[model samples]
Target: MPRRAEPPARRATVRDVAARAGVSPGTVSKALNGTGQISRATRDRILAAAQEIDFRPNALARSVFERRSYTVGLITTDSFERFSVPVMLGAEDALGAGKISVFMCDSRDDPIREKHYVDVLLGRRVDGFIVTGRIFNEREPLDVSPGVPVVYALTPSSDPGDCSIVVDDAAAGRVAGEHLIRLGRRRIGHITGSAWFDPARRRAAGLAEALGAAGLEVAGDPLYGDWTEAWGRQATHILLRSCPEVDAIYCGSDILARGVGDSLRELGRRVPEDVALIGTDNWEFIAGGARPPLTSVDLGLSTVGRLAARRLLEAIGGNSRAGKEYVPCHLVVRGSTDDLPPASTGSAS
Candidate 1:
């Protein structure tokens, strides 16, 4: 039989670029990343050599030398949901734009799996990590991966030493509460997320505060449940029965808001007429095109993702990590709420 052709040799590397550019491997890296006080001329020559030789930097080896994997770990509980995809995409887009890679892990809300991912990601020397789900408040001082910069998407796990990005859920809730109050709805009910999540708890507090400021209280005990449509529907039915005079309902999320609308219809009540409804997660893409639109609070999930990614990148680049950062939320009004005639400014219900 004819001899098999010899396999092609491995591709050129940063070492090759360094040799062709008459510089060191470190210099080549500086040129590629565009930093480290290297002269423009030297950087250009190094880049030219790399392009000529088609040099591919060894990511794993480079990570070893620099104590950086240039890889980010994204750990989430609900990793496969529509709401989470935007956040993951945002983070991936930001990091990948900088030529970084990502490793994703799902905790499935299991504490054991969550802790295991922390160790696994750290073992891989990932430059940073992004966590989403519930804000972990470090109920106790648990040792975590040392030197790994971590940021939370919506829920911030409590690590005072770590940086985090969160939406002003309290502000979102307050806005929703005030809007209903302004619409002359005095009897308002609330369907909120479980107290275990900080965002949900804070939002509920804000709702209460807003109502209190208006010289009123929640029409009834706030209905608490998970952040799911099923819970929202169940909570809505209970609220209606418990607070028969309620004229408005504030749902914790757009998903819940949709359920609330459905339940209202089933109860022979017209939305906005018998019970105006509001929810968080503007969910414009999901709610916008509905026959009657849904009003919601825009928590800026993409913004949170982008901000967290940027902060992680900055930390990896040796920037000083600071305390937590809170991103603001905006309210998007739609047809789910009443279409009252325009009112003069500064007028309260």
Candidate 2:
């Protein structure tokens, strides 16, 4: 059989366009870019030649004059789990729109792997990096040399001088607590993940603060347990026995809240009617699918990603701001807590 045809030679370039247009490369550039005075006829000729050669301008080469690679490195430690995915999406939305490409790297929380990616991205001349994890806690700074900007997202840098974008866990709990109180549920209880997690502790503290503001205390000392539905169920029993008058419950996560809701129904308590409920994360499927859709606090993880990306860009632009930045969390009201009248449609009588 005849040898396979040679792969289409290399991609066309400015030189090829100039040669085809019977003009110098400098003239081709001036004409195509309209940056310098060039006759309309010559500009049209250069354009036609470029079209014929199928010239695809290299973004890197085109951006060379700006002294930037127009690229970024996005490093994640949680294998892009649910928590990190939204953050990444937000970062990509901001970066890609600015003509900056992102090189995604999953370090899987391995130090060696993270270092390798750092070396490779630096070699590629990435302008900056956004390091993130599933949980928004303080972590050691990346091993890259000084002068390279790295913004932490959903995770903070151990160094107070490094910039970090994180969720406001206290705000999440405060909002949940305030909402429950607004619904006339004064005897509130809080159950959450392990005490080791900053969010868990902060959320619990915030709830207590909100309750305190109203001259009421949490039904009992906040119950700390695993972030699981089973734990939610188990904790509910414990909380009820300890504070039999508990009228509402706030959980650290949606999954745990689901368990709380199930246990409450089994124990002959009506959601919102008897015991209002709230959860964190506001994950749609989990919150919306509940018997009475769960009310939850949205931690705004995506907003954290977006702000982190913006901070990285600012640093790359020579206006670096340091220290931890908190993004506010907001509550999403659903049927689980307050029952409202049906919405009215503008229909003729």
Candidate 3:
């Protein structure tokens, strides 16, 4: 014969909490939902009562009452790679602070997939959206309801009226150029990706501007090719062949810089001794892993994401603005451009 088990206690409700606080259920609702104003002391009492009983309000029921899901849709065309991941992470941090959940979707650069994601997220009734991509080019605006807010990060919307947060590509190149100039390295050569890419053209222009301001000029015309190590190696050979007097080189990306450095070593050019090197993107895995490390410019990708999140939150709050907003770039110095000890190498604005 087994002893009968005792019955479990019933779960507490709003009514129970209200009764314990000596107030009506309506007052408890106001305090819990932060809706109608209640006296500070009264609110505190109700909160304490709810806490004492370990009361957990029903989020689903509350969302229905408030008509807000407190959730956001984050869509990316880059498949969450090197560029979009940081942006998404930053957006998540800001949205999490607002007590909002995020539904991440990768479109894989497919228009049909992106449309499907937009439809699904709209069906879920997300509060707003944050759209991002790998490149700095303009993309078509998201196909969502007119009133629903959308903020673009890293990639601007084709519509000039939409809100966009992007990196200052020109600033990145200028910063690198100025740093090399500070080290008294004139006759700087520029090597980068395709001229067709907006970023590559902007960076080249920025470098030329910086050099012009210092009463100098680029050692030769910018050699643009693909954004690959092989292109970088090929471009370096072409640049050195034509401008052997080049005392410094600025590369569009750290990968390109690595190739340039390898080529320079083969040509018996000592980094920072015979030729200083500067790369963009400050990608630690590539820049920090180089033989002598690389002095590179950071594009502030995460900052762009955070700003986009903030802007989207503002739009959700009925305060929205349009147009592009640029985040500044910074430089991280290393042995490739400086003779300082490894321990002393750090960031410079």
Q: Cα lDDT of all candidates, in order?
A: 0.78, 0.87, 0.88
The weakest ten consecutive residues by lDDT in model 2 span: 340-349
* Residue lDDT tens for model 1, 88-131: 88898899888889898888877899889878877877777877
Tens-digit lDDT track of model 3 for 178-284: 98888888779999998878889999989999999999999889999988888888888898888877888999999999999988887777787878999998889
Query: Which residue pairs come into collision in candidate 2?
Result: none
Give candidate 2 misplaced runs (Cα > 4 Å): 1-56, 340-349
Question: In model 3, what is the error at residue 213, expressed in angstroms?
Answer: 1.3
Cα lDDT tens digits for candidate 2, 194-293: 9999889999989989989989889889999998999999998888877766778999999999999988877777787778889999899899999899
Q: How accurate is candidate 3 locally (lDDT)?
A: 0.88
Name the lDDT value of residue 155 in candidate 2: 83
TM-scores of the models, in the order given: 0.77, 0.82, 0.89
Q: Judging by TM-score against the true structure, name the best candidate.
A: 3
Q: Quote model 1's TM-score.
A: 0.77
- Estimate the lDDT of model 1: 0.78
| Residue 246, candidate 3: C-alpha displacement in angstroms | 0.9
Task: List, in order, the clash count of every candidate structure.
Answer: 3, 0, 0
- For lDDT, the strongest prediction is 3
